[model samples]
Target: MESLHRDDEKRTLRRFLRRQRQALSEHEQRLAAQRLCHQLKALPEIRRAKRISLYLPVNGEIDPTPLIEWLRKRRVEVYLPVLRPFSANVLWFVAYQRDTPMVRNRFNIWEPDMRFSAQRQNRLPAWALDTLIVPLVGYDANANRMGMGGGFYDRSLAFMHRPGPSPNLIGVAHACQQVASLPVEPWDVPLTAVVSDQGYVRRTR
Candidate 1:
């Protein structure tokens, strides 16, 4: 079996996903996104978490912007990840209320104001985050995730695997991002669950 890190496999998948991302008409993409939103709304895991961390979309990844908006309205304290300039580590934080201002950063990703974070940040040990909604290129029911090779999330999860304080780690992918299986490394963090437009699947291995 080809491993995910295999240069050929990653290249092949990169091209495939790029084409797939471009082929979707905006309407089709948004509808697919809406379906995913609906499916997620019905998940007990989401409902159970009071504090959550999510990412701003890049490429055509399922936009969690809508979910973030709704979460705040429901009084759910939500956090967004801020990747430090030139650093892989992120400052996961809250303060993205509907009224929060966003500015285009050098990375071209829009970010919320720093004022949203506390003057004295909680900076939970990675594992202590109640729920981490991770982004993925491909995932399978086995809880494996294929990322862009940045190793940010992987390292963060590794930090969580310490003696105590690891929270539920879930991968959020588009229905199209699912694959037959994915290759994982010893240091790779297995996801607790994966959710797509189709539904949620827990990896039991």
Candidate 2:
């Protein structure tokens, strides 16, 4: 079927790009992360944001911790995505602070501990944030993103499809992850902009 073919194509591209980024040496990865932090911090949207959500890098994903720290110093509230309990393909953004306890989620990624009842008080809805820095396996100049195929972000950000205000969705990735184009799906949420080690790619469309 046509659907099956598109799925296969996406799988192939994801495998290739994941391998490409993972192949980078430690030094290369570190340098790329530093440059990415520099570029991201310079973005006017980022500097103006009072609240933001950022992810901890894993599996060769560009590190955003440096930027997170910078934001914290500026008194900007930083949040991390927590897998919503009992919710299918959805996430809750929980405030991340120095004292916030962390636990590894099902994917083995560290996230703010949601088990503590107090943590719930700090949680914010996805659309409530001013900006969200998302990790991507691959992206294109058009601001289309290729995620890890979990659909978590797509589902949580589905509100963007409706109307009204939406947080600025920014995709972060290594320069090597840039593809000529991506086969975008109807369910996939497009990004407002993408920041890579090379520079920022603002979506004209």
Candidate 3:
């Protein structure tokens, strides 16, 4: 069936891209992270954002931590996504700071400890963020993002499909992750922009 084929294609692409990024040496990854921060800081959306959401890198995902100090200096509140309890594929943004308690989630990723009273108070809805930097398995010139296929982000950001203010979704990855094109699914949310180590791609519909 057509649906099965699409799934197979996505799986293939995801494996290839993940391997590509993982193949980068430590030095290459560090350099890429630095360049990525520079490109992101230059974005008008980032400059104007008071609250932003970012992720910790895993599985060769581009590291965005280099931008944290810069954002902190600018007094921008930084948040990390915490999986919503008992919710199917939903995430809640929790404030992250140097001293914030962290715990390994089911995915074994470190996240703000929501059990802490202070951390709980820092939670915000996704739409409330001005900008969100997401990790990408692969992206194209058209800003179509191929996520890890968990559908967590797509489902969490489904509100974008409705008529309402939505956060500026930006995908970040290594330049090598760029593909000529990617299949877009109905449930997939298009990125506002895609930034790579090289620079920002000129998004075309």
Candidate 2, residue 92: the lDDT equals 98
Report the C-alpha lDDT of model 2 over 29-103, residue by residue, as the tens digit: 999999999999899889999999999988999888888778988999999999999999799999998899999
Clashes of each: 0, 0, 0
Alpha-carbon runs more than 4 Å astray in model 1 = 1-5, 85-91, 115-125
Which runs of model 3 end up more than 4 angstroms from their true locations? none
- Worst ten-residue run, lDDT, model 3? 196-205
TM-scores, one per candidate: 0.84, 0.98, 0.97
**Residue by residue across 77-127, what tens digits does model 1's lDDT show?**
776665544556544444455566666666687766554454126334355
- lDDT (CA) per prediction: 0.70, 0.92, 0.93
| Reference-based lDDT, residue 186, model 2 | 84
lDDT of 3 at 69: 94
